[model samples]
Target: MDMRKMFGFLFGLMVSLWLGVSLALAQSGYPQPTATTLNDFAHLLNANDAAAITQLLTDLKNEHGIEGTVVILNSIHDYPTGDDTIEAFATHLFNTWGIGDKADHKGVLILLAAQDRKVRIELGTGYENQYNDEMQQIINEHMLPAFKQGDYGRGLYQGTRGVIATLTGIWPPDERPVQSGGGSNSPTPVTTASSSRERSDGRMGILIFGAFVVIVGYLILAHIFGWPVGNSRSDDDDDYHSWSSHSSSSRSSSSSSSSGSSFGGGRSSGGGASGSW
Candidate 1:
């Protein structure tokens, strides 16, 4: 073919591929979030439960500067692109929606695919790797029981509460108080010292493990070189300090939202845990 015809054909092929990809992505079965905190597309939560969960998440964001959202879908397999596992779907949706601050990366997504009997707690890059265990614990201790009993609303609410507790070190009221005119109710504020204790224990465990590794490494090096091992110091304190400093500095400021408010443009690198009931 002539150069002109060849170039034209190549351009046409590129355009066709681009259009096809765009169309496929557009029909990927991800629902647009209408509310900032909750998108109950599966109709798993009742009006009260939904409102309560929304209020809980809204308060969490405003007070603690952590952006969180919950999504409920009937089944991923119901759509052409929903055939993927819950983990992939949650990660894609979380990044696509930008659930938290782009700079802070403090976003969390609680995804429930009801028909599939699967759930995922997707955390942003801001969270530590160890939180995966904590997320799994939340699913196992708080969520799975309700799910097995077919109490989806309870399961989701409890799961959300567990998430909030884990992140904030405080649990809000279990239910939102009644409001006038059927508007969003404000739950009475409550606090507890238990979650804080739990977080401290987790941190202590990590520090101990780190120190143990450091000591073992020092012993091994000393033995190899036939050097004295009278004294050794660990910089675990510095490491822990740096981690806390980063977490505090990277928190994104929360802004008020309405029904039309969207996510905060944050991204996640698939840091979370998944479960099946």
Candidate 2:
């Protein structure tokens, strides 16, 4: 083929491919922010769950003065923001929606793609230091199990709680609460002598009362029934087994829905992790 014809054919092919990709993305149901204030655009959450999550986010902002949102997408196969990893898509979505405080950039986005079986915890520039490890732990430990079991609601709920706890220092990444009574680096101080003495007395009184009650009960039982008590181990085991079966059946029949909203114009430099189940 002549150079002119060949160039024209190549350009046509590129345009056709681009158009095809565009069409696919259009059909992929890429989520659009229905309302800036109303989180859960994808409608992954049911009405009640969505309301609860929105309240939690609002409280987080009110208490800590930080903005955080959760975004759940049906799939990311033809994500509108470009065919990218969940991490990249999350970052783009976070910035596009502008999630956190405009000046401090203190926004956090927890993005979950149900069909893709992926999750991402994308943090704004302001939260990178505080949230990085905690976010990962939340995803790996709390969210993954629920996602694997198709419990998206539980996953999002636990993940959001983890994020909140981490930021507020209520739950450190180590899964331990910060000891309240000490200097920044010092160990929590031992209890005072008077407090310890009171606790000891309290324990002793409880133990003596418990022993007396047990002795009285045993004497009454022995007098009425005349010796050793009958063992109820077999009956207890049967009841436990029945309860376990009922619980297992109930768990298997459960389902969950989730919803989320757009961000507050916060930007990211690709600072988050991604995972799949």
Best by TM-score: 1
Instruction: List clash counts for every candidate, in order.
Output: 0, 21
Residues 1-277, model 1: lDDT tens digits: 4785666556655655664565444444455566879887655566888888898898988999999998877666554445479998888888777899888898899998876788999999888464898899999988888777666667778899999888888977788444344323122111234324334544564565456445444443433333455444355455445444543443332123233657788988999899998
State every prediction's TM-score relative to the real structure. Answer: 0.61, 0.54
Cα deviation of 89 in candidate 1 (Å)?
0.6
Number of the predicted model whose lDDT against the real structure is largest: 1
lDDT per residue (tens digit) for residues 7-100 in model 2: 6556655655664564453333235454433344334555545665666677788878878877766566534346568877887777766778
Alpha-carbon RMSD to native, per candidate: 22.2, 27.2
Off by over 4 Å in 2: 1-30, 35-42, 171-264
Ten residues in sequence with the least summed lDDT for candidate 1: 183-192
